[model samples]
Target: MAQSSSKRIFLCNSCGNEYFKWHGQCPACSEWDTLSEFHPPKSRRKSNGAPARKTTKLHTITHKKDRKRTSSGINEVDRVLGGGLLPGSMILLGGQPGIGKSTIAIQIVAGCGKSALYVSAEESEDQLALRAERLGINTKNLHVSGENEIMNVLEQVSVVQPSLLVIDSIQTVYNEDLDSLPGSVSQIRDCGQQLLNACKQKGFTVIVIGHVTKIGTIAGPKMLEHMVDTVLYLEGDERYDHRILRSVKNRFGATNEVGVFHMTSAGLEEVTNPSELFLAERTANTAGTAILPTMEGTRPILVEVQALVSKANFGTPQRNTNGVDSRRLSMLLAVLEKRLGNFMGMNDVFVNLVGGLKIQDPAADLSIISAVASSSKDNVIADGTVLVGEVGLTGEVRSVARIDQRLQEAAALGFKIAIIPKGNMKNVKSFKGLKIHGVKSVREAFQIIF
Candidate 1:
């Protein structure tokens, strides 16, 4: 077959590996059958800008913080957006289907109640209108354009000159310039690049709503994330209505600064203090329940950790955890069993982060082990104690990062007792009002808490 050739590249979405041809397996991330071919549009032969933008020195780059930003009028969005949308900035918001990525984008664009353009290759205007009705957002300022073709979408963007622009999804926008179907690797890369370029040149705030794969990666070329200024992931268990907008990448502010939103009759409602929502109302004190303080961006949050210990029925012990890594939990359990000799080897240990938000940080390790030990021993931890430390495989309690920040955050939130590492304890010496306990090993940790 004669290839009507276009210079293109195949990128592994799992690892950001770029290749000349598609492969059955990724050479980098070792993900099976995840190669997606992408054909990017060559810059228009004649219309390309001359004297390409020069890379300026770091100090030479002008700082213009005082520049005005058009607020989306949604406090949660504004906070997640680092005060508000920077003119011509491209923001990517990825989430599960029907998890309200579109809803939040639509809500944000509805600001100023001015005519903002909403382009959706996925949903028709009628469908979007129905959603708007359900959300009760008056779409008066929202100019709706339903299209699949990238050229047509660009045309609408050029003609409307909307103050705010929202693409319901980046995956569905297909480009005729790319020799592939929409949502394919090539098409997504080309469409995303073009949209980002247009956003920068046009000075219109653009939010590209995206869909994520089951493994929690944005369902497109990894280049899509790099090409944008901000990348936000909307997280929540599909069975639950609450959604978390977490900044995975941010050029304007801190990544990991998250805003909590609950999907409801009105729309995505912001939860100012997510701690209350994460902690269930427990009338009575229970063993194996721990509250830990974590710093998300600049905000401090208190989350509950629960664990249960039962006699293991099988030859090998079974370890399970929710909203945390099972392998890490297993290692922590092993530390407790081997070094501390807490008789947890045959226990069917189960650990859970009260809310469904997955915490991959190593700091949660000590709490996981503590929760399980507390359960096994049937001892309840103090109400004010907040456990924060990394438990090593050898049963040593490693110092956690940003102890001062954690302590300050914990102190701000009314936590009085903190179980931290010995190294951090020596550095701080004294934690003024809060009773900070330093533990070197898992045994010490247990003794200090229980």
Candidate 2:
């Protein structure tokens, strides 16, 4: 038979956009070096062994479906994974180097108590065993292999037939059929597709550990996230002992849920009461500190927001922020200077969310503004007061989501006063053992708190 001729094309791994030729950057997503040479799917030849069976109707088929999930015996991981691990589900876990990605994977396998196969392209078998021993995990059913070739890993999977399969650092895995090297756009895409297909064919749960880029995103094509059933990001500053496991995308459960863990010499341990842990060492009456009740998915956590305003000797004032967006800090500063006539423009300001946990909740806006104001005036806020509300560009305070939950958490944490948006106050009948102060604008918030 004559070989079928196929045209060569260039594809953007980020947006799935194809181009006639290669370019330095992807025009669709503006990501540099994301375009790679594409290969068309090879046609499969039919075997001479058996004939194809007729398709059955959906209603006529009778199957015993098992919807039960396998629990990893770790409450923090279970929470982030939405109860437990579902069979045949593909999960992509991404994190920076030395962020306990492998530690968590081995812990989960040990807790599952079932047969598990771990394939690593980054670490040696002896290295994995040593870490596992240090973590106090002794699971006889867990199998380990150090294979970089995708085909060989699949072959081992066939022989073992384990219930759980884990791939350490998917970027290191490469398919021999692909011309591109490992970690390239084409190799990552092809290897991920093949692993996902194999997982679906076999009834086993698979978790793929991924490397993050310099910008803190998963080091692979954007389609790599879309192809998985769940995408989780393990985030936390290396200098701090606390780590947060956050779910960015989930097909089977809710997203934006977070799991807090503290790194110990043994391994990662779950923090049941994150609010207490975050505010344990906070000073009683600090000028630059403000506590805020923020919601992390279904759970409410109270975190301290600290700010510092100092005179800048240089011409250009510096704006530094940790565990928060710098752009957001700049916007808050502009709002303060415009609406409240604050002297934030001439001074250098630094804002930090305590415990090294990143917060995207807009409800903390009021707390941030108040912290800056408190620092500028050098006046400490009253003890047991928690701020919760969003600040609009027009200086008006906006209502946040889950107001009741936030108030309840604050009250349970021994907070005596709660400052919230006026809109959120009208709907709340009452808060137990807590005083609710409603504010319509940033000026009103500062007057009530500062």
Candidate number achieving the greatest TM-score relative to the actual structure: 2
Cα miss at 331, model 1 (Å)?
1.2
Task: Report model 2's TM-score to 2 decimal places.
Answer: 0.92
Best by lDDT: 2
Tens-place lDDT per residue, model 1, 173-232, is 887766678888777777787787777766787888888888778887777898899999
Provide the RMSD of all predictions against the true structure, rounded to 1 decimal.
3.3, 3.0
Worst 10 residues of 2 by lDDT: 41-50
> What count of clashes does model 2 give?
0
Q: Where does model 2 exceed 4 Å of error?
A: 1-8, 25-27, 30-32, 38-65
* TM-score versus the correct structure, for each prediction: 0.88, 0.92
Cα error, residue 399 of model 1, in Å, equals 2.6
Model 1, runs deviating above 4 Å: 1-22, 25-32, 37-66, 112-115, 408-415, 426-433
lDDT of 2: 0.87
